[model samples]
Target: MLITLIILVLAAIFFMNGKIRSDLVALCALILLLVFQILTPEEALSGFSNPIVIMMIGLFVVGGAIFQTGLAKMISNKMLKLAGKSELRLFILLMAVTSAIGAFVSNTGTVALLLPIAVSLAASFHMNPSRLLMPIAFASSMGGMMTLIGTPPNLVIQNTLTEAGFQPLEFFSFLPVGLICVGVGTLVLIPLSKYFLSKTGTKEKQRGYKNKSLNDLAAEYQLGDHLFRMHVAPHSPLIGKTAAEADIRNRYDLNILEIRRITVPQSRFFKTISQRTAPNTVLLPDDLLYVMGDFDKVQHFAETYRLELLDTHMPEERSAINRNSLDFYDIGIAEIVLMPTSGLINRTIGESGFRDKYHVNILGIRRKREYILNNLKGEKMHSGDVLLVQGSWNAIGHLSQENSDWVVLGQPLNEAAKVTLDYKAPLAGVIMLLMIMAMVFDFIPIAPVTAIMIAAVLMVLTGCFRNVEAAYKTINWESIVLIAAMLPMSMALEKTGVSEYISNSLVSGLGVYGPIVLLAGIYFTTSLLTMFISNTATAVLLAPIALQSAIQIGTSPYPFLFAVTVGASMCFASPFSTPPNALVMPAGQYTFMDYIKVGLPLQILIGIVMILTLPLLFPF
Candidate 1:
């Protein structure tokens, strides 16, 4: 019992520190328990095969399919159009949509999918992004309260009840309280959000000048002063020569940024091939060179080599050049911050061979308050340095996968045009509806887990996702591992009589006040614990205790279980409380105080609503 308590305390400390991954913390606890013979190997490993875990895996695939098919994006677009221009109306619509989608998808995925839309809407309305982002983050959490598969805590509590020899909560059992909270939350947030957010005037002024274009990016990095475009003449000495042979850098003191190649077809037969500049790339007739050099020197060199200087100041001409120079259909632009453990740290960009390794061109580097644009090849990389990179979406996606090395920032709006909406969207929607129906109405006699599994397989079979591998990659493995590792903690607690002890204490202290107060006390305690550690972990630890407490007090466990469910999902007081909150922090430019100011009141309001409503619905 002492060992289990120590492990739980240490795990909570580690989770609060936020330095170690939550899964790693849980795994370490599980390993310690196993090493000490606290649990048999079979008991410790059971979570890996739990039906709840399997169902979560399947649900991840379904969510991924919905994202890949752009159904979520389409819904967001429609919602934004309906929102019109009023900030209050937009806030309500955004919250409603995010909450609805969040109930079915991972909150992190829901936030990622809608972040671009939120930012774009904020821009169109000339409002500060901070005004809209936090609300969306909070709304996603509220949304997860509505369904069984909406959030992991919901499943954890349901499984706990089932294992306790009680009937599990139905699919829509949480709906009434969840809907009431969301409705009440919307009413409270519409007017109160502005007071907690950053003042609109300063933030808007700072962001209003922001533009998304290669040239604009270059300008921001102070590269525009020397950037020039020169066209290769048919008879020029560089016409038939490769970049290495031309010795443009050593001879002319210039670096070629890109090569713009435009092929005019004799008939409608061949397609154009756009390529980036490299040493081995051979120059051809009419090839436009985007080079960096002094204006006068570049002009003199261009005249001496019979090259035509293309005016870049003209917007239309620059746009045309960009269109024909790079295939934006397959390319994207993103900013990635180097993490402390990045391998590239202390290595010069040239030494690291960043372009060659990642298939991405480093456009500029932002370190501290300075932008390193010129002579970036020799600049040594550092942790926290942001790299503005341009590359194919596939390459960017690859970079994003290496989360240990880099943290990809906000949505790359420049690449938004390239995301082709999958045609299988309707089919994916139908499959989702069928899955919901199977769970809600028992239209299919199969277990809920089987229904989810079938939906995931059908998503792949119908090509709702690009491929099986894509669906596999979409699963939140960290979350799965964390849940699996923490499951054993519940077992350890029970074995040590800790759950019974805690439940007895709770009932002895609060039972005289009646089951409603006991329910409120459990909810409040769970909510406070979740503000630090994961809500899923909190649910796993508290659900059994709540059930045990109800039994001790001689009351039905449904209201107590419902309290645990609602409390675990009320993670609004801290930015680190939920994945969606953390994901939106940078984009929203929010502080710890922002969450406390906006979320604390809502948390209290929801708690009150839950205490008042759970008893009415479930009847202790």
Candidate 2:
């Protein structure tokens, strides 16, 4: 008992600090339990083999295939470019994208991929990143409510109950409530985000590229916007001419982003001047060409002219300073991460003495709460400040050193990246829907996990995913680790009878009101804690306790379990509680109090909904 208490306390503290990695913490706890003979090795590692674990892996592969396909980018280019039209439109479209994807892929997966695009699009529109970012984060949560595989919280609850004894929920069992939540949530966000978010919401357009609207890309892109491989054949008519002389651009409307002399193992560089080159360069046979044009046009040019266009890899600077150092100041501007923990996490451009520190000038600063003058150097760092710094490459690298916590964003160079899907290349929406239908109807006679796995397998075999490795790369591992790590704590709550202890204490006082009141008590307790810790972590901790209490009181556990699940996920009151909160925190320039101001009311509203809805929907 004492040992379990020690583990519980330690787990609580570790989860609270969130400094150490959650998975590592979970691994340690699992080992400790096994060593103390509190659980058998099978029980300790059971989370790894849990059905949810297996299902998540397969689902990630499916999600990866979607990512590699660049479906979202194509979608974003169409929807996001017009974001300046209305805040409500942007909110609806962005959340709709996230939720739709969330229904198919995992919520965390949706956020990891969408968040950066959201940041960039928000920047493109000169809107506050906070306004859109937080909505996407919230959408991830709300959307996950729509589908079982949409988030780990739903799966965790389903799996835990199944592992304990009750039949696990079917993939679509939560659909009714999930859809309602998603619909209501999206509607609420549209009107709310403009007022609650959008600091310095400005309207801007691309400075130089008078490119056509994004609709063109949606209608045209096949694999990548600016990524393709081409080969220059020996007998090709333009073989010995200079690359610029090859008329690559004039002939195909293809922007040759990068070029390499080698045919195989093609590579990329930023689409900028490669200075210090030989005066009279000439194209050669077997040379690799990296170009960007209409996807089909590029492919057609590659095949028609025997030219190899390597995928245009836009090398974004990981550190704004490093990028700025590389003469990126020539064109690609640096956006300062206002907070020290931001990509510019620590050491202001000024205190690192950016000017004397590196001949760089601070262009602008986006404070978490309000727009501040760029000159606030002596200010102690806050969380979401975008400091637009101007510098040379050397100075930028100096800023992006090991001791600091800043990050840079630009062209995502993910070796971990799978080949994106070809827009205009055809994913066949009907086919995708059919796959989901197969799962919902049990025509495949397997779990939803297997259904998704089979879809990925078919996609690869049909060449939709391109290759096996590409499909595997799309899975989000952090979410899986979070689930595995939190599983043990949930188990320990039951194993130590700590759950029964807490339930007895609560029921003894509320017993006179029956299980309904006890359920409300459980709901409030978890909801309060969720305001501080992560929603997923909160859910994991309370699930076992809810279960034990329901059994002890001789009533169905659904009402109590439902309360804990919904409450744990209700993280509206504080930025620390959810990623959506943090994502928007920087843009809104809000203080901790802001979340409480708006969120407290919403939290109350949610509590009322859960109290009324759970019993009516599921029955006590």
Candidate 3:
């Protein structure tokens, strides 16, 4: 027990220091417990198969789909209209909507979906996003208190009750408490956020360089004038020939960007197919080749190959091919700056074999302020020259990893996220609704974990996410491992008689004052511990003790358990107390003092409210 206590204290110190990852710290503590024979291997590894852990993983995928399909963003955008131009209205609506979304989605994901929107809205109102962002982060946590699967701490308490042979909580058991939390939070945060946050503006200089949009890069290179499309005519010499066989770049100085083929299915609807212009890619009859070159060279190539030139000078066509054409679903463009130490600094684009080596076509080059568009194959590469390259999004992403050669500007993958699967929004919405119904209704016969698994799989199979790997990327392994590692500590505490010891001390100290005061003691203690460690970890450690304390005092454990969960979640005085709080720190230009000034008051106020309200809701 002494060793276990020492390990726990060391883990708390490491978690609070934040120099190392919290997950790593927890795992170390778990290993210490195992090494000391405090827990057997089976006991140590049981958390991996815990239903709470499985459910949390599933929820991450479900919430990721909701974000990827733009469903959450669309909902929030529509709701913002109700706020009009009133700052007070926007503040209230932001809290309400964020909390509402946070109930269904992970608080981290809820903040991610709403962060940019909040910033944009604040910009529109001529206000700093700092005023709205911190409050939004806090509201996300408040929102998580509303649902059983909304937050990890909620799941911890629920799992504790189930293992204790108590009546399991219903889906909406936390709803009233969640409502009170949001109410109290909203009331307390309004003036606090306005006064503290409005005084600080976003530190744009600290954010580093903001990458330009694809359209901006295209315009600067004047790529539209150099880009042309040619349709393969009958008996064309280019028919059935691969790009390598035709040697188009050498013969005509024209670079083929991609091949677009159209086919009419049995439904008689024409479907357009776009493929990257690989060396061995075969040219089919009637294929439309998108190429870049001087107008004269493009015309010359068309005449030489018996292909018909298609006019793209119309406003709609030009706009479509420029703005809407590269939807980044597959093919995309990005700028890469050549390094001074690059091996190909003095080599021409053709001599460097960029197309053969990287499988991407260099459309244009920017040397200092000069834009070189035509005959790019012969344009010698220079240090600090920015090349506008177009290829498969995957190819562009590969360029980013070549740090020794050049720096791929902006985030290529993040740019792809902007191109959402909006078509799947309704399908994702339906899947979510069905999952919620299954969890909420007693007749469904589906366990909550089963419901979440079904929704996560459906999100992937139904194209709510891009693919399987994309789905996997949504799960936060750190948090999952952290919670899994910390769960065994709770069992350890119970088995070693630490839970009884702590509960006895708590009860002996506060039992005479009535259950209300004892409940407050548990609530405040959990909240205080959470300020230093993860809330989920705090809940796992303290939940068993809270239950034992209630049992020893001869009162219902529900209110005591409720205090544990609520206290664990309502932490806000420190930035690192919760992921949502840390997520908004840099964007909000907030310092440690900012969180202390704004979040401390709200945290105490909500703790007091929950202490007064939990007993009424659950009965002592």
Candidate 4:
């Protein structure tokens, strides 16, 4: 018993430190228990095959099917249209929609789908992303409390009850409490969040390049001054010469951005079209040279080379010229940051052959506090250096797939952004609804696990998901392994009399103050522990103890179990407590203190509501 307690305490400390991954910590504790002969190998590994774990795996696939079908994107578009230009309406709508979606899907997955939408909305409204994202994260957690499969902790609570010879909770058993929490919580959070979250004034300097125009992009990176246009003359020395052969940078001290050559098709009567240019592109008479150089140097070079200079008259014309130069349908500009583990680090751009390999133009590089726009061919690439790249969208898509090499920043908000919804959306929706109906009505005469597993399989068989492999990848293995590994700790507690001892101690001390005090104590303790550890792990550890305490106090265990469920799901006080919180932190530009400022108060309010409401419903 003493050894078990010591290991659990050490595990809690490691979990709070955040240096080690939570799954690794849970696995280490499981290994220690096995090494000390505290649990047999079968008992320690039983969590791996638990029905609850299997259901979570199935639910992940189901959620992925919905996401891949672009249902979330479709919903986001409609919500934005409904909210219009009102920030308050947008905020309320986003929170309500995200929460509702989260009740039926993985909260982390739901947040990931909606984050880009939230970021785009913030950019459009000139509001801080943090102001919107924090509430979204909190609402997602509240939404999970609405259904059994909304989160892993709810299932874990039900599993504990079944193990103790009690009837498991029904699928929609948590709906009433969940609705109350989500409704009241949103009412409190909508007004209070503005005070807690940072207000980044009008899009003076948004984090990424999502909503900026071509001219805005150029000015931000200081590329506006160097761009110029020159026309190649009929008798120019550069005519009939390829860009590489001419060596424009060496001969005229200018970098060629593009060459606008008019091509005449054999069948065309009068149409003249522009073609994409490359280093091997041959120059012709009347071809426009978009070059980067000093105005005086460009003028002198034009005179020396017998070329005609194109004067910049209107900014609108210049913007049009710039926009028309790039084939927006096929090409785009993106900002990509080199990750620390990138293999391209320490190599100069010239040596890396990035242009030849990736078929993208490296416009400039931002290293540390400085932007390196000149002499970039020899500039060595470093981890964390941001590169502005222009290329075909296909090439950019390929580059974005290599996450280990670079982190692609905001994709251009314009262009044919990847379609989030497909024709399979209706089919996916139907499958999800059928599964819900089966669980709610017990139509299948089988366990909820069987119904969920069948729905997951149908997701792929019906073509909602791309393939079986894609579905498999959607399951969060770390979460599965962590929950499975932690289950043995609960079993060990019971076998060692640790659960009984703790329950007796709680009942003897807190029971004198009546069941309401005891319920508050259990709820508060679970909520507090959840702030620093995995909520699922907290529920697994405390559920059995709460059940034991209820039995010792001679009352129905329903209220205590329900309290544990609510407390475990209320992990809002800290970002590290849940995956959804961590997922939105960077996009929102939030700090540790930001979560505390908003989440702590919200957690307290929700906890009070749960304490006041659970006993009345369950009659403890």
- Per-prediction RMSD in angstroms? 11.2, 14.6, 6.2, 11.6
* Cα error of candidate 1 at position 365, Å: 24
Q: How does candidate 1 score on lDDT?
A: 0.73
Give per-residue CA lDDT, model 1, range 169-220, as digits (tens). Answer: 7888878877887898888787768887847324344443234554445456
Those runs of model 4 whose alpha carbons end farther than 4 Å from true positions after fitting are 1-77, 160-168, 199-504
lDDT of each: 0.73, 0.57, 0.79, 0.74
Q: Taking the tens digit of each residue's C-alpha lDDT, what string does model 4 give over 1-620?
A: 99998988887777657577667888999999999999999999998887766776777787677767766556656777999978889998998888898888667656755675676677667778888887888888888888988888889888988998988888889889889888888888887788877572234566654555544556767665677777787899988888778776556656676676665433122223353446778888878777766788788888888987766542222121233223333345678899899899999887776667887778789888888877777789999999987666667777877788888776553332332325467777777777766654534686767778898999888766544776787677766776777767777876787755764565457866878898988888788767644677678778887888889888889899888888888878766577677666655656556677788888899889889999888887
* Regions of candidate 3 where Cα sits further than 4 Å from its true position: 58-76, 83-91, 101-177, 191-213, 229-253, 261-273, 283-288, 295-324, 334-352, 377-386, 394-445, 451-475, 508-511, 514-600, 611-620
TM-score of 2: 0.50
lDDT of 2 at 399: 52
Which one wins by TM-score: 3 or 4? 3
Give the better candidate number (2 or 3) by lDDT.
3
Better of 3 and 4 by lDDT: 3
Question: Per-residue lDDT for 334-368 in model 2, tens only?
Answer: 44354335554555443555554444445445565
The Cα error of candidate 2 at residue 137, in Å, is 5.6
Error of 1 at 39 (Å): 2.5
- So what's the TM-score on candidate 4? 0.53
Name the lDDT value of residue 239 in candidate 2: 71
